[model samples]
Each structure stands twice: as structure tokens, then as C-alpha cells.
Target: MNHAATTDMADAPVLDEDPFSDENIANPYPLFERMREMGPAVFVAPHGYYAVTRHAEAGIVASDHTRFTVEGGVGMSDIRKPGAWRTRSPISEIDPPEHTRVRAALQKILSPLVVKTWKDKFAQRAEEIAEQAVARGRIDGVADITEAFVLEVFPAVLGIDVPPERIKLTGELNFNQLGPNNERVARTLRRAAPIMDWYQQVLQRDHMRPGGFAEKIYEAEDAGDFDAGTAPLHVRSFFRAGVDTTIAGIGSTLKLLSEHPEQLALVKANPTLLKSAFEEALRMESPAQVMFRTTTGEVELGGVRLRADTKVGYHMGAANRDPRQWEDPDRYDVTRQTAGVHRAFGVGAHVCIGQMISRLEAESILGALIRRVQRIEPAGEARWRPVNTLRTLDVLPLTLVAG
Candidate 1:
């Protein structure tokens, strides 16, 4: 726990750990514990980046972009370098002033008023989905509930005409591509190969429906609120950033609620705790496990100095479970006041803009299910979908006992 800053930057601990390894990607908490025990910031030798494990240091990495700049790209690889990614997200990949302007434009488009109006729509769909799930009783929580609800409501709100299967495939491809280009990425590329063209074309202005959120983004672009030709990219960002992660979080929520009947009972007794239950699920298994930033200069994190221009990944999955910040961090306690405290939605200005939408979605679906189901019990073992930098459930079997 003693992470005394060394004057010699090279004195930082070097771990040969490959976090993207299939084993670690499947279940990372053990390695995360080891990494946290090592130091707040340790150089990951294999990937040649520093891993920030503790909560405080991770916060610094996420918020103080002055020290850990986003200019090098948010992913582990610096996109500005040769033969890397060609396009940066109009939102995530940029810094202040220009970022400020784009954010304002986006905020105006996705204003509280605009988002609030979708509540009834989300609730109506949520009720139908929940009723169907309860009627079936036995169900794959992933397909029957989580993916089904999110795939239906999220895209409808976004106003894109993507098939559910294609969205799921492309989501797998995107999350895998975020980290190392390992077998997982290769496998996903093969799976998504046929639909790559469809993925690209589906986000275009021509594809946006009149009343959907994507259409409004295009309208904003037309009104000089965004750069020409960036409307599609913004919509693309919304799709990529919003859908899969929410599905992952919601799936985890359902899985956890089923496994922890006590917590479910608490939620059932006090309906308000349903929100906390979802928050706890997100804390336990964050969808986006790690987010990267490049050090602008010699940056000191928890007294460990990081090399300039090197990538530093703030392991949200690890930080959320840090013993220093969270007491008995591994236990899934529904009463835990985790909403603002946990790093699940992220820290600082660049935090998930769609978090309210995510919250709305979770609350709507979970609320409906809670109202109808007396007990949510596991039907079989749950299997995690192993993307390099995402923790999500691929298969969650559940028995929805109706009230």
C-alpha cells in the first residue's frame, strides 16, 4: 500500500501481465487484485502501457486530461501514430474548447426535455417485454430480456434501422477492437465480416428515421453545430457507446438479482432499491472494463511517475473494487450507495453522456419486471462474453416467477 513517489521514473514496477489474455478477459478480478497490490500505477510490460489500479489514481487519469491527454486516442494504441485508426470519434477523441463546442451542440440536441419525453415510450416497451418474459417463466436472460429489451428500445430511440442480430455482432466487434487485436478480435472480425458494409451504411443520414435521435444529430450538423460529414460519425458513436454497454449492465443486473434473492426481496419490498441494485451490478461487473489515456508529460500517479506519451489504462473494473475505496468490495450489496461514487459511468466531463438514458432504460425495464415477478431465480450457469476490454454476459438463464 506504500506507493512512495520515486524521483527515478524507471523505478516504477513493471508487470508482464497481459490483461487482454483470454483468461484475464473472462475473469479479471484476481489479476486486478494482484495489480492493485503491486502499486497504484505499474507499467504493463507486454502492452507497454501503465495500469492504474487504485481509485484515486484512476480518477486523476480520467479527469486530469492535462496530465493524461486524450489526444493520443482513448484506446490503448495511439491512433495518431502510423497505420493506426484513421478516424477519431467527433466526441470522445477530442480535447477542450473544440470538444466544449461539440458537447454543447450535443447537449442541446439530447437535452433533458428531449430525453424526458422518451420515458413513456421506454416504459411501454418495457412493460410489454417484462410481461412476455414473465409469461415464458423460464428464459435466457441475455436473449429473452436484456438483449431483447435494449435492442428494441435503445435503437428505436436512436432512430437507426439496424437488425438486433447485426447490432449484437457489431457491438462484439467494436468492444474487441478497443483493446488488443487478439484472437477475440480476429474471431469477431470473421463473424462480422459479411455485415461490415451494412454497419457502415446503416449510420448514414439516409438511414436515420424522421423522429429518432439520429435524425436530430443530422439536423444539428446541418445547422452548423457540427462539422460537415461528422453527423454519421456522431450517430455511430452514439450507437457504439450506448447499446452494448447498457445491455451488459442490464444483463448483469438481472443475473445478480436472480442469484441474490435477498437483494431481490429487498428491492421487491422497497422498490426504490431497484436502482441501487442496478448500480451494484454495474459496479461488480463494469461493461467497459478499462479506458486509456496517454500521458502528456512525466505524470505522477499515486507517486509512480509515468513515461511521457505512453498509454495509461485506468482499469475501471479494478478501481471499482479497490479495497481502499470500497469496503468488502467484492460483495454485491444492494444498499451500497454506488451511483455517483462508482466509476462505472466514468469520472469527470467526458463521462458517459448517455448515462441518464441508460439509467432511464434500466429503471424502466427493471421496474416493470419487479412489479410482475415474485421471484427471479437462476435457471442455469451464466457465461460471460469475453471481449478484450468488456465484461458482459453472453448467456444468462433465469426463471421468472410471476407475482
Candidate 2:
């Protein structure tokens, strides 16, 4: 746990690449390779933070919270500092003891029984949507399938009732704010300005529908499971963390499946591989690409010495593709054992609390499709959405052939 410096700061390689630049954001694999090749950790001069690029080092930083803490916030900026745009999530931003309590309460609310019940509902909806998508033949996978399925079912389970347009706007705003304050962040904030009020109001306890999971969070808060007044923030955290990431993940799964028909065939031959398909997709293109942690003191990461209280960004997309970790990192092989190994959902304590929910949702939709469709082919180019820290599809044109 003690990461007291054993190496000189000069050993750390410094690079000037702008990680959030339009070109880099659009195609980061090249830069990711460069960063990983540089060393386990490299100082990204443009962003003014050290990046943990290699899979092993990223795991070390994530798991050993005593050395690299989340208290400074999970974004590029230290939330403890002045002029920070983000507020600390009562769940994600706190470290053990405090985080432990909140997470336990959340786990109780999202129990296995509750998740299984939701899975049944998700499966029914997925079948309905998959039937329609297969019938359509040609469709924008992002809009018609991924967004349609997740946006409908996820919020319904959360007990939220917000327009899809507003959810997308707010999601973009939240993810953008997690990165450096740039033009993209400014633009998204401006676009989301109109819905800001409603976004806040929707997470309030009164807005929660009866018998939904979100209502359970409020109930837990009332029972002293959480700090008073922390209920809304918990609701907000679930909404922010749950929606966009799942959409990105599911979209990536479909895109990968469509492009790699052979792999899709593997899943079709044995539908059990549906979960593996989603896991591999997430590994190839992680939804939450970069998450930041603060160095608690002078620490040595991948043999590089970092100064105390500095922000260290873990590029999940980069680490997930680290050749050191997997046999063929770039290739999307559905059979790869990537579920616990990949950095897609992260590692250690702060590993996404809702990962099971995401997997279940993905399994439902993908299982439904693989069962009904004979083949999935790319109809056109798959365009990447240029969110600062999120790697998601903007438009995926696909042609689905029925079984």
C-alpha cells in the first residue's frame, strides 16, 4: 500500500500529445500504443496529468487506493481544488469506510433477486425490439437498437421518467465535464442548459415512481443507510453512471458483431457466448475511457515517481488493449475470457457497482438477437461520437438478416 517513491521523477517519460484533441479522440489507439510503449506511466503534457496506460499498472493504481485515492475525484480535475466543475459523488468519490457503507446499501437495493426480476422484463422487451429490428433489415443500430432498448428499460427500472433527448443531452454534459474543460465541454453544457433544471428535479425523491429501484435508494436513505440528503445524489449517480455507458457498450457489441460475422456466428452457434461477446466488446472499446485518481503522496507507479496530490488518469480503453495483458488485444474475439480481466468495468473496490445490471441488460438484448437473426452485416461506416472521455458510436449503419 505504501508507494513511497523509490525512483527519480526524471525517469517518467513526458509526452505532448493532446489526448482530448479531435483527432486523438476519434482515433486513440495509435496514441494509446505510443503511451503504453513509452512506459507503464507517462506524463501527458497537453492534459497536465500522468496517465497509467498499461493494464497491470492501471490495476495497481485502481486497487491500491491508499496510494492512489479517489477522494480528489475521479475526473481530470481535483474536485477538492477551487474552480472544479464536478461535485464529488457520495458513492464514487469517497474512499473506504464511507464508500463501503454507501456501496453496501446500494448492493442491498440492487440485490440478485431484484436483478433477476429485471432480467425477465428486459428479456421480454429485448425480444420485441429484436423482432422489429430484424424485420426492418436495414437500420441505424445506435438509434434504433442500442438507444431504444437501454433508454427504455434502464430508466423504467430506475423509476425515472425523462425524455430521451434530455437524457442524451445530460449524459453528454456529465461525461464532458469529467474531462478537461475544453470547447467540447463548453458546447455540451450550453446544449444541456435548457434541461438542467429538469435534470435536477427528476432525481429528487418525489419524482421516483412507486416500487422502482430508485425508490429503494430513497427508502435506504430514510432508514439511515445513507447520510441524510444524500438520496438525490445517489439517484443522480446511478443515472449518470448507468445509462450512457450501457448504451455505448451495447452499441459496441452490435457494431463488433456486425463487422465480425464469424464471431457473431460463434455466438449464434452457442448463445451462451452472448455474455462473452458483450464483455469482449467492452474490452475493445470501453465506454468510460478515462478515470482519474489522485496520488496520495510521493509514489512510484510503474517505476515512475509522481508528486503528491497530482491527478493520474487511467485510460481504460488503452489498458484494456494492452498487449501485455491479452493475447490479441486489438481483435474482437467473443470467446476471450475478458469479464474479470479487462479494465472495461474497472478493477478493485470502485469497479462499477452496476456491472451486473449492465451485463444482464446486454445478455437479454444480445441473446434475443442471436436467436432471431441469421446474420448481422455492416451497411455503412461506423462513426465514433467525439465525447471528451467517452468512446461511443454515433452512427452504426447495419443490415440485419432474419433467421
Candidate 3:
């Protein structure tokens, strides 16, 4: 494999060519292919950041915190620099020692034991949605299935009393804030502005429902497991991290399976493959499309020199499909063994801590759906909703055949 081509570092594409522009965002494979072939690291001129499109480079950038620090902020735009409206994620922005403390505390409350307890809840919710869609014979996957399942169950586990309408709006704001300042960010910011105050109130310890993880965080706070006042933020962190990504992930899986009949057939025949179906979808169309890190010192990646404090964007969607790492990279294959390998949930110390919960949720929900669905045919064309840092399906229409 000739990996040594003199990569033209200066000629990389611009973000105004809008990677998230409606057309490209809906189907970004063509653009991802261009970037992956361009180099391991290519300059995204419009956003003025380097994008690591290769699987290897994405992994390196994610794991090597010394070279790429999260302190600068995890979006294409630097949240630390002046005028950025986004506040740092107490969980994602802070690196180790501090990050370790916060993450460890949350991990204990979200342990496998706690997550396993939700299996019945997720299974019941999945059955309800799957049965409805199965009865209908045709369904809009995003609205009728994926969003319904996640929005129904995620909040229940968290013990939040959020309204259904607010879920999508809140997700839009959170994910948009993770990207560069753009129309998508601006629009979602406006949409979420009115509810911002109420959003704050719901995350507080006072609002936490009894027996929920939010309540457990308060218990930890009371017991001196974490800073006295950190409980609200701790609860807020789960809402921010867990919600939209899971919706986008499960939505993408449904869209992929609908579009690829053969793959759907495979999953139906071997129900265990439902897990891999979700993994393959996460690989092909990542939920968190990019995560940023700032350089603490001068560094070089793929021969391009970067200065300290410079931001780098690792495109997980691009990395997952990098031809160097995946054979027939764009194709969705249920048996690919791609679960832990994909950067969709990220890597290293800051890798998504709630991954097991996400997996358990997806497996339980998707598993139930697969068990009932004999075939999933495309009911209509799907559309992608462009957010700054996430890739998500806005709509997915799928027709199902009952078992």
C-alpha cells in the first residue's frame, strides 16, 4: 500500500462548500470519499481547521491528548476563545485528573448493573413501537420508531419530565453548539432560546425524579462523592451527551437497513446481527460527525505543522469510511465486527462514557424491532437534518413486513 503521496496540504476543501449543506449532509459519502483520498489529514479551509479523515489518524488525534488537547473545546469553533456562546461540557472539555474525577463518579452511577435494570423498560418501549409499526405496515422511521423509542425511554431513565416537543429542539441546540458558527447553529439557537430557562430548571437536583440516575447523582453529591453543587451539572451532562446522539444513531440504523434490503434480510435471518446492524450504521454515518481538540504545543500530523492552540477536527464519518481501514467502506454490512473500532462514540480517555448504556439501549430496542420485522423496505426517501457537529436523519420512511 503506497501511503506516501506528497499530499497537497494547502488545497483542502472549505466548510462553506458546507459539509453540512442540505445536499451534502443528506448524502456525504461523495465528500467523505474525496477527503479520505486527499490525505490522512487535510486542511478544511472554510472552517480553518485540519480534518483527520483516515481511521488511523482519527484514532491518533483522539487518543493523543498531549498533542491534541480538549481544553480548547470540542467543536470546530473554539469555545474557549472570546464570543463563543457555548459553555464547556464539564465532562467532554476537561482533560484528565479533573476529567477522571467527573467521569468516574458518573460511571459508578451508570454501571452495568444500573444500565441492565433499564433493559425491561427499553424492551417494553421497543415492543410497543415495533408493534405499532408492524401493525401499520408502513412507517416513518424517524418519527414513528427511532425518535419515539429514544425520546420515550431516555428521559424515563434520567427521571426528567421533558415534553416530547422539547426533546428535538433541545437536541438541535446541543449538537449545533458543537459545530462552527453557521446558519444551522444560529437557527437552532433561536429555536431553543425560548425554552432555555425551563431547560435549566429541569436539570437541577430539585427536579430530579426519585430512583432515577439524576437522583443518584444528588445522592453522590450529598455523600461527598462529588463537589457539593455539581449534581445539577452532572445530570445536565447526561441530557447533553445521551439524547441526540442515540436518536441520530438509531435513526441512521433504521435508514440504512431500509435502504439496503439485503442487509435487512441478513439481520432478520440472524437476529443477533441487529447489534452489528446498528454498529455498521454508526460506522457508515456517525452520529457525532466531528470532535475537536486544541494543540498544546507545536505538532505535526501527516507532515503538516500545527501551532499550539490550533484546533483540529476529527471527522468520524470520514474516518469510519476511510478505504484504508474498511473494505467496500461505504457498504453497510451487519457482520463486520465494527462495534468498538468505530470512532462514532470516540476514543481514549474522553471516549463516550455512556457507550454501554447506548449499546444496551440500541440492542434492546433494535433487537425487539428485528424480531418482529420480517423486512424493512424504503417507504420514501430519507432526509438529513444538518447540525453543526452531528449527522442525523430528520426523516426516515420505512415500510415493514411483519414476522
Best by lDDT: 2
Candidate 2 residues lying further than 4 Å off, grouped into runs, are 1-10
lDDT of each residue in 1-403, candidate 1, tens digit only: 1124435545469999798887888889899999999998888999898999889888888988788888787788898988784378899888786788999899988888999999999999999999999999999999988888899898998998888999988888888877876788789999988988888899888898889999999999989999999998999889999999999999999988888899999999999998899999999999989888998876677766777789999999999999999999999999999998889888887898998899899999999999998999999899998888788998998999999
Q: Name the lDDT of candidate 2.
A: 0.90
Question: Candidate 2 deviates by what RMSD?
Answer: 1.3
* Candidate 2 structure quality by residue, lDDT tens digits, 38-79: 998888887788999899999988877888999999999999
Between which residue pairs do clashes occur in model 2?
none
Q: Write the per-residue lDDT of candidate 3 for residues 1-403, one digit (tens) a residue.
A: 1123323333343443556667766677788777777776666766778778889989989978878889888877787879976667777888887888878888999899889999888888888888887899878888888788888888989998899789889878878877777788888878888999999898887787888888998898898887767778777778878988998889988888878888988887788888889889899889999888987766767665565577888889889998788999878889999988998989999888888888888887778788887788887778888777778888887888887
| lDDT, model 2, position 328 | 80
The whole-model C-alpha lDDT of candidate 3 against the native structure comes to: 0.82
Query: Model 1 Cα RMSD, Å?
Result: 2.5
lDDT of each: 0.88, 0.90, 0.82
Q: What is the lDDT of residue 321 in candidate 1?
A: 98
Candidate with better lDDT, 2 vs 3: 2
Q: What's model 2's lDDT at 11?
A: 55
Error of 3 at 207 (Å): 1.0
lDDT of 3 at 290: 87
Model 3 spans > 4 angstroms off: 1-17
